[model samples]
Target: MEKKIITISRQFGSGGHEVGMKLAQKLGVKFYDKELVDMLAKDGKYNADFIEANEEKCSPPMCPVMPGFSMPVFYQDLPSDLIYKGQSKLIRTLAERGPCVVVGRCADYILRNMNPVNCFVYGSLEARVNRKMSMIPEGLSFTREEIKKRVIDVDKKRAKYHEFYTDKRWGRMEDYDLCVNTDKVGIEGAVETIAAYVEHCK
Candidate 1:
């Protein structure tokens, strides 16, 4: 029983990234996080930062208005939309290459057809705020309230992105094969659970 591919969709401050990385280490497989964005940016059509901004969130890719400006009639596809398409192809390609763990960027939805292990990581708002507060850089000034707001904001963006692209509700239990609450099992435990789930799968 080999873990061919694992895709993790997570809430903003839920330690999802850490879990994915650790699981990859435990499973001895390649891991893709921001690396996916870097690969997508290789052709130079989109920079790492640009892809980071629009890749995970829809920013309403199909909508004419998103954030700073509106798409003109001449521009058929928005930046976010193009980035999504690129990442979809890239994620699938990477999965095809070998076993790997991919974090965020809707990898689970993108890799759905591959029969990959799909996971969702999440925690309560207070738990997320606490975890996020500790991760903030030293000397950086940010209140717990600020961190909480940021967590909320990021989750909203992710939900929007998932729904727009997959036509499925984000955080919906049925969509994911496994859901872990970091508030309960913690990061390491979540990683172990996901790894075990992968092992349990065909």
Candidate 2:
């Protein structure tokens, strides 16, 4: 049987990671999300936090500013173009390795030629807010207002990044083979549905 690769693009609180992990387990293939970030961190010799901040941020082109605000200067150490290039290269390298489930970092667009089984996960705002609240780590005091703002901000950034890189609208059905709503089917159901889809593609 030929193996298939699945790429899931999702809203922040849509339980996409849970579904992807379950789907990867069922398909007996590797799952990548945070691990991909860690791999890039190791390979590029940069901290994971730095990679996370710079990963999907389509920053405006500008020379580095000095501490004293004396003048804007270009830094050879941090090339502006490297941010996108490095992340895109890492995503491609991972896909080239084998059949795997990759979440976020625009894997869908990066692997466009590979014909990956692409999916986009979304959910109702209420459902997403509730999920975000429940999933908040202990000691974190995030109100619904905060969660709502965060979700909107992240999705906006994702959309901007997608458009900047691929010139395609984000969260569009035409961009993916499957679109799953976690609110309708729940996390496990979404996983089963994707597993079925992956099997069908084989």
Error of 1 at 143 (Å): 1.2
For candidate 2, the per-residue lDDT at 53 reads 74
Best prediction by lDDT: 1
**How do the residues 28-113 of candidate 1 rate in per-residue lDDT, one tens digit apiece?**
99999988888989978889989977777765334355566655444567777899899999989999999999998888888888
lDDT of 2 by residue, 62-162 (tens): 66677988667664434224556776787788779898999987788888888899999999988998999998999989888999999889889888887
TM-score of each: 0.91, 0.87
Off by over 4 Å in 1: 60-75
TM-score of predicted structure 1:
0.91
Cα displacement (angstroms), candidate 2, residue 72, comes to: 13
Candidate 2: which stretches are off by over 4 Å? 64-81
| Whole-structure CA lDDT of model 2 | 0.83
Candidate 1 RMSD to the real structure: 3.7
